[model samples]
Target: MKITISVEQPTGDFQKKLLALLADHADDIEPDATWTKERAERLYLALPTNARRIVKEAADRGGYVSADDLRSGEDSSLRGHSAAIKRAVDRGARDGWWPATLQSPVQAQGPGFGKVVGYLIPEYLVEVFQHAANKPSRDW
Candidate 1:
């Protein structure tokens, strides 16, 4: 059975009991967490500078980076990198580096259909991707 538990500020006893239960099932548990550090690092390493920049931008924004802001007459970093980014993500899935069911960490989102305001990294996943990059980003 698959189980997911969300605990915040768990007590010491609760933590110990959880660990004991997990240890007992360790043999049956397969590593399937999406947005894992290793997987994120691998995928990030596989991407080109432009694609990586897009990821960093979204991550730096704490999830969503605006595409409306042109950089001194330049197009948004996400503008020309979409296809290459998609290919890189697909390759990662095919190579078994990341989970096949997981969608691209960088996603285009907006208020409604046909209106793309920016790419969102997902608040929960920003930290993982940032940790994977392991570097400071330039001003975006």
Candidate 2:
């Protein structure tokens, strides 16, 4: 079944890091040329299932790196990479590989709860949902 996913635009630290990374790749590159939600979704679809799984699991765990983590310099690159993985998963969800209905309940609370429910959907499925949502007749 096709699932439709809606995603908000990337903002704040996520946007800044992405722009910096792209700028480092080449001179004269426009900061605005960085990947958009549509581009991110496509990249997510191209990833192998294993990579997608790693990303999805990480997102499920809410393993976001804080500013302190970056400043510490220990495992900084790893955390950045993980953050990129998270963006991909988020884009995949936006595109529809992961259905909104299956997303872990936002209102849910308690320790270890998100881990148990959030990882239920595989990454590939999230991608599917995202693509489905992008179809012409799909609603937001």
Candidate 3:
């Protein structure tokens, strides 16, 4: 059987939810194609800088990165970028760059969102997010 869904230039939250439903169901049909590079790229560009860094690191680490692992000599804030990290998906959804219901590229692991121990990028999105994160940004 085959199904065809056509919406005329969908927009708004309802549209977002509907699109998300379709994408989620894609997991059952063909999970690998759910997170395409183009979609990841669009959402990646819409994310904040810190959020992008977190995603890049997760991609590099095969879809899971501890927030503590992100700290470096120059950057001492080792608790992970909570504000930016938490807002990653919302920002993308609000901007209409991606579906609001889509799973986050960076999923924080901790106690009830109180403290993030780490971030997990979906296995399917690992390479897609990596490609998006590595793409050169506008140097203007």
Tens digits of per-residue lDDT for model 3, 10-126: 779879899688888875653232557777777677666777788889898899888678777887574546456556657766765555556666777778846677888878778
Per-residue lDDT for 24-44 in model 1, tens only?
989987756577877777777
lDDT of 3: 0.71
Deviation from native of the Cα of residue 128 in model 3, angstroms: 1.1
Please state the error at residue 110 of candidate 1 in Å.
Answer: 3.6
CA lDDT, candidate 1, residue 99: 54
What lDDT does model 2 reach? 0.40
Of candidate 2, the 10-residue stretch with the lowest lDDT total is 101-110
**Which has the greatest TM-score?**
3
Candidate models: Cα lDDT each: 0.72, 0.40, 0.71
Which candidate number maximizes lDDT?
1
Query: Model 2, stretches more than 4 Å misplaced?
Result: 1-29, 64-140
- From the highest lDDT down, the ranking of the candidates is 1, 3, 2
- In terms of TM-score, how similar is model 2 to the real structure? 0.25
Give the alpha carbon lDDT tens digit for every residue of 12-72 in model 2. 8887987587678656442232333454345445455543433344334453223232233
Candidate 1 Cα errors over 4 Å, as ranges = 1-33, 70-77, 111-115, 136-140
- Candidate 3's C-alpha runs over 4 A off are 1-33, 73-75, 78-88, 138-140
